[model samples]
Target: MLSRPDVAVVGAGPVGLGIAWRCAARGLRVVVHDPAPGSGASHVAAGMLAPVAEAYFGEHELTGLLTASAARWPAFAAELTAATGADIGYRTEGTLMVGLTADDLAEARRLWAYQQGLGLPVTPLRPSALRDREPALAPRVRGGALAATDHQVDPRRLVPALRTAAERAGATLLPTAVRRLSDVDARVTVVAAGCGAAALTGLPVRPVKGQVLRLRAPGGVPPGFRHVIRGYADGEHVYLVPREDGEVVVGATVEERTDTDVSAGAVLRLLRAAVDLLPELAEYDLVETLAGLRPGTPDNAPILGPLPDRPGVLLATGHHRHGIVLTPVTADLIADLVVTGTPDPLLAPFTPARFLPPNPAGPVGVTGPVGVAELAESADSAGIAGSAATGGSAATAGSASVVRSAAGVAPAVPAVGGRTGPGPSAPEEEHTWN
Candidate 1:
């Protein structure tokens, strides 16, 4: 039997790492388990950190979360880098949403207007102005929008840095896969396991498959594209993210309720759209193609904070594609909740109980929320002992709390930094692509 920890965090992706790091930072003994630590979606992400550009319809909650996370990134990066001596390649170059055709332009305009309606800082740009700002864009492009507050970081660098920082913070990282959460009994167990959450039982998390392509920047291709460029064409969203080393990553096709295999059709479709956006990309060498699963939830938002039906368990998964952008804030909030028993106000809307049937009295019986006991019971009812073992723990019964319940629950809100919110414009700073 493993020693009990204050917290046992499942999955070692960015979210899990972030939780473990934050918990350890607060002096909590943390144990993190993953088959391959840092080798999940977090590592495979394009690392676009562009909350504004990645905006979706009816994702206000996610947008708020992203904004909060973006605001916390600088301090998080600085501390991690200082401790691990690793450069996470954080950049504040902003992002450009370009349109290569009339349809693209119309969509860009619509999105820009929507952003404006949300009180977000978005600047409309003509084709000529866009070309002037980013000479690499095709001259035929008509218009675009500039979200100067959207920034990016290199996931490859950031994940490793986070892993190092978590270790330095004294979290025990187990390289072995956790077949079951029953292996340890902690004061709290957080299920932050991305797509793998479903396999652990009781968690309603499922995989939303996504595929991305990596290409080597050709000679004469600028060493770095200052801003992440994204656009829609052929009914798909395509992005070109340039790394400092001249490796341009063009990605991502979202396929729901399926296995995470890089489909040739998806690759062809993505590359075709990428070349359509920037014809010059045709000259680059295709290097790698990979696929990963983003954790999907019912509302397309993360299931955060404590579970109403499970006292010592927390739900921190289901971030979908915004996981990379929301990492820092998620970590901070999880740590705050576990250490002090208080959660961030922003986390209220994402409570796991939102998915549970409302019980005025309290959670009871087997049909409450998708908590630990419910999952374990379901597995047993199905005679799936393996699943039950993996599911882990008992459920607690209570209504959600509106009050701060403990001392370590709220971190002193630090001075916000990075490009976030509708703020005054600043000169574009030089940013490394990697």
Candidate 2:
């Protein structure tokens, strides 16, 4: 048994570790629990910090959160590096959103327009201009846009750095699994357990299966391309993230399934899409192919703030694909909340109460692609006056999410479809910015 700490954080993924580090740095006694700290979706993620390319219709609140978090990444990366002396492979080469065909260009244009309307910087580029930036792009690539703010980091390195920083800051790490909230003895307990948050809190945080591939350059040489390439290739949306160490991260398929098996179809589709966008990838060594699950929520946004049913328990899960980019802000906000016992306004839009049964009397609870803000409207229509509508704003229609309710408690299942960018808006791009 471990000594009771001031704060106990469940799960040791990047988010949990970051929170632990922040809290410990604030002079609080912190302990993090997880058998495997860095073995979740954050390890499997490509780590594209793309709030601009990821901005889609009906996700204004999430977009705001993403942009705020992205802004914090620069300072966060620098502080972490200075503290741990670990190079997390953070890069600011920005991202290129391209289209391989005329039709693909048309679809991409729609998304870009939506992104631009939000005051995001998305500059349209001619094929010639794009090639000037990255000559390795397929010549047939019709056109593309540039989101200069969309950066990337190597998640594999980041997880370890966070763990080290947390430990250095006087936070204790326990190689134990927390199955229930009652098991932990702390003044405040945060559930940052990724997909496991569902089993612990009965909140809707599901496992969104994503398969990723890592490729090495020929003879260990660096990739020819400098920018992260996210595009619509013959209708298949794909992204390619390059690293300074001659490794290219190619990913992923968003499936509702929970299994981690990497299917042949997923590999072929990914490779085909990648090669279609950048023919040079065909020659690179196909190194690692693996699958992991991203924790998704009913509104496709993270679940923050205190649990309505459990006072001392706070939630910091259901980040889905934006885990890497959102980490800095998540850590800061959650740590501040822990220190002050006050929630930031940014957290108001995404709350666990959003998923609670609107009318516990009627089996009506939250599930599937519905925005937490919409819960307020649902409550109004049901004639049930409750806080399900509190601290939430309207998440416009055309939203993709995961939610489930059973016996007034829904085991966290990923809000599967609430992805943004590419492929007819709703269930947009699950593989874009993880």
Every model: Cα RMSD to truth: 13.6, 12.1
Clash total of candidate 2: 10
> lDDT at 144 for candidate 2?
95
Model 1 over residues 205-305: C-alpha lDDT tens digits? 77788899998877635443567898877556799888777788888887775666787898999999888778878888998999887888878888777
Listed in order, each prediction's TM-score against the native is 0.81, 0.83
Give per-residue lDDT, candidate 2, residue 338.
59
Model 2 lDDT per residue over 340-408, tens place = 444556776876777875545632232222222322332344442222211112222212122222222
lDDT comparing candidate 2 with the true structure: 0.79
Global lDDT of each candidate: 0.70, 0.79
Candidate 1, run of 10 with poorest lDDT: 410-419
Residue pairs with colliding backbones in model 2 are 198-412, 205-412, 205-413, 206-413, 206-414, 367-403, 368-403, 369-401, 400-418, 402-415
Worst 10 residues of 2 by lDDT: 424-433
Candidate topping lDDT: 2
**Steric clashes per prediction:** 6, 10
